[model samples]
Target: MATIYESKTTEIKPFTYRTLLITPDENSEFSIKHSRQQPKHTKKVVLLNLVGRTSTDDIDSYESLEQANLFPLAHHIDNDKQEYEQYSKGLVQHFLFLIELQRLWKSEYDELIDLPRSSRGKFSFRKSDKDTHQYREAQIKALLEPIDPSQAIARTTATEYIGVVVKFYSFQIRNGYKFNKTPFEYEVVSIQYQGDSTSIGAYLGKDVHIKDLRLNLGKSRGNEGGALSSSHKNLNPITNREWQAVRNIPTNTSQVIKNVAG
Candidate 1:
């Protein structure tokens, strides 16, 4: 369902996070051993509370409305480009999962909404819009298999949740025990982004603490000599196996897609 926008003085709650799933202990060995492990599948579930307005008119029309409303509105009234795009993409994918689940368990679940028509052109839910649907379908297909309606429908459900936890740890081994300058050698199991200069969490392994990943918010690590050197950024050090698993993904999307898709 589209997000509801209320007119009263609204006190929006903070976004909540959750651990969807934990892979098998053996699969998690990549992080525990601080080296690349065999290519193994894994998954995790994350819950994000999206607070935004959705119009009955259609999501596509909002772009035009923004043009007409141009400058007079407060900055907060504007949609956060990154956040909104991310949320919508995620919501669409999750909604697709719900549809698939409903198909599988018709008696237990009902679809929240019918697919909306595209505002820009005549696009049906089928292959009419191949470019858009391809990505959305791929994302949804991955999710349907992993999502367990047995748990809460969404992460916010009060009961226990296990189906959402992510599994899969695949990275390559370079020089084995060495920590630096290894090709494709990073195993970022998890990340926490606050949208600030600091405190970008990257859990590489059970051991090996990297200070830059946990800097204080609004602070610059470069001033404190925590800036990663050119070499550090260049060395992916992943094994052929793990690299293949994440090969199709672009570097910039690696963390967010991995975390959110789970």
Candidate 2:
């Protein structure tokens, strides 16, 4: 008899934040609807930042502010239930990404991952030898690099995730939840949208300047001919054989259709 060997694969679970749906008490001031007859119960999405915490019940005051900053957007009057829920979920994912980057930094440098709290108890990241905007940005990019090329995050998704984190920091700054040294450095640049000549901003001679992150992720200068370089270096059009195979798929057969769909 021959001995048989079995290969075991371990699955890595992604980090996630906790959310609670709670109905306010009768005396509570929380109310989304202003109708004469309010519903018996109204639910609210509470996003808790449990980045490195061991217990969900161990949230502090500073963490409360971090969680509360997302409440306005999560329960915005303009957004419906589904829309608000999505926003909450996206915010949680973005925060988790930052937490992952922080873990990478801590493992590499053997130092505290998060910004230090000030004497007044406000979040602040004062410039230091170990902590600087450039150093942090480099660490973030390094962590974001894909270990397996096939499992890489899409450029658009990466951009959106970072944008959400930047916006969250901006909101915290505006609400006095954080002081000096934001998570990322940003610049205001006027963006001209193509094929929007009749837009109000264009007509009114107003340049719409938005906060742009300075992480320098996918930046490229034009070539000598002044043409912008292509970012999709590995992308290629399908060959005739590939196209024919796709076109000749036997969808009428149940097994074939199932295989194609999968």
Candidate 3:
């Protein structure tokens, strides 16, 4: 396959490949508005080339490959299908190994667990629905009995959208919740009102699913003493129970490095 090196000053990330495809007349679409435009060749390349199945020679023979049918290359469509499948299996194994290593480190260091404990500021808890007032009232009472009398914990109620799932530490929301009982260094802060999309990648190469974590100060709809203010009119409805984004925190990669090093 033909290789081209891009200048380092450009905004694109570096890419490595095993095979490449070059398509002519790329500017045809753009040229429709301006006939004098020149057509450029469109180039495609496969990264982390799989040996035998993917190579410099395979670029020319792709139209004949069955796997090429899946990718729309100019050569053979079935010739290297088996090799492609094997490559996929190996990729999954590698991803799982990385995830397991992350789990081991978190267990030993409790990296994510210490953030909330370190925050000395006051915060209220909230719920996702308001339909069951009696149940929520009792729940709030039970949660507050053990806190230091001077430290007041309020309940603010809110509602979650249909099909929205939250990940939170249940024990953390309950009185007598101790830091040591949490998983690895992770604790159940609350099953409260944060919104999360399906996890796209947390395990094998195939976008394995896992719990998505979020942090915020606001409460959801069903908590006691809730309010609707003019300021919240345009916030995302899915996470309306709380402000969609956390503001006022300084974010930097150095903190992640510290969490890892700790």
Candidate 4:
């Protein structure tokens, strides 16, 4: 019999991993509302950069201070605790996904290109580097078209993540965070509606022109559940027979009810 050889593969982990850390914010109004005498404690989500040297302490240091502002923006979006946490989680996931993509792109570029390790620092390309640019574009396209369907993130989830990131950037811009070049592009799209349409846009003479921000990632696939989709299952009133059946069900206090009635 021929000898069989088994090869072992080593997993490559990134040097720096960005993660979300939920901490208590004493400045939050909700915390103050709950406690009159003691200091208030509210949920404050921070994005921490692991395995990296920075001027500030790990607790205060983040991948981006603007990204850390997501917690306050999330509260403004919704005051509810659960909603705030969900929004924070989505935003964190978006940032982490981008970081992973950057790491992978750089790794691939380094392997293909004949350059000094020091020169291949960033995962960006100049206009003259046509081949490098094409490679990056191809990588982005591949991300949209998943090779393994089962491993891919759900369309709805991807949409939520992108939306959260967009909202965070918008918030930063509104607060006077100037970017040398805007991260995304925008185009004015005119939407036409019928005169008899129930939409609010119908009142604006059927032609509604709005500036739609075009994100780097392509449009999300699949339908996001709407009010109508949620309400598809119509509920009907229970009959008297069904109500009596529910009342007749045995309980620990059945004898107590009978004695009280008697």
Candidate lDDT scores, in order, read: 0.29, 0.42, 0.28, 0.41
- Candidate 2 residue 75 Cα shift, in angstroms, is 5.9
Tens-place lDDT digits, model 2, residues 1-262: 2122111112122222233344566898554534443222224444443422223433232233344445543344323232334444445565444444455554566335655323322323543321224333533554366565455544455555555555556666556665545544444455445447566554333344355453556543322221122322355685676555455666543322221111
Model 1 stretches astray by more than 4 angstroms: 1-83, 107-262
Query: Candidate 4's error at 54, in angstroms?
Result: 15
Assess every candidate by TM-score.
Answer: 0.17, 0.44, 0.16, 0.39
User: Which one is best on TM-score?
Assistant: 2
Angstrom error at residue 58, model 2: 10
| Top candidate (lDDT) | 2
| Model 4: ten consecutive residues of lowest lDDT | 2-11
> If ranked by TM-score, best first, what sequence of candidates would result?
2, 4, 1, 3
- Name the lDDT of candidate 1: 0.29
The TM-score obtained by model 1 is 0.17
Q: Which sections of candidate 2 miss by over 4 Å?
A: 1-46, 51-75, 78-81, 84-90, 97-144, 148-151, 173-178, 182-207, 214-239, 250-262
In Å, residue 192's CA in model 2 sits off its true spot by 13
Error of 1 at 68 (Å): 24
Q: Clashing residue pairs, candidate 2?
A: none
In candidate 4, position 259 carries an lDDT of: 17
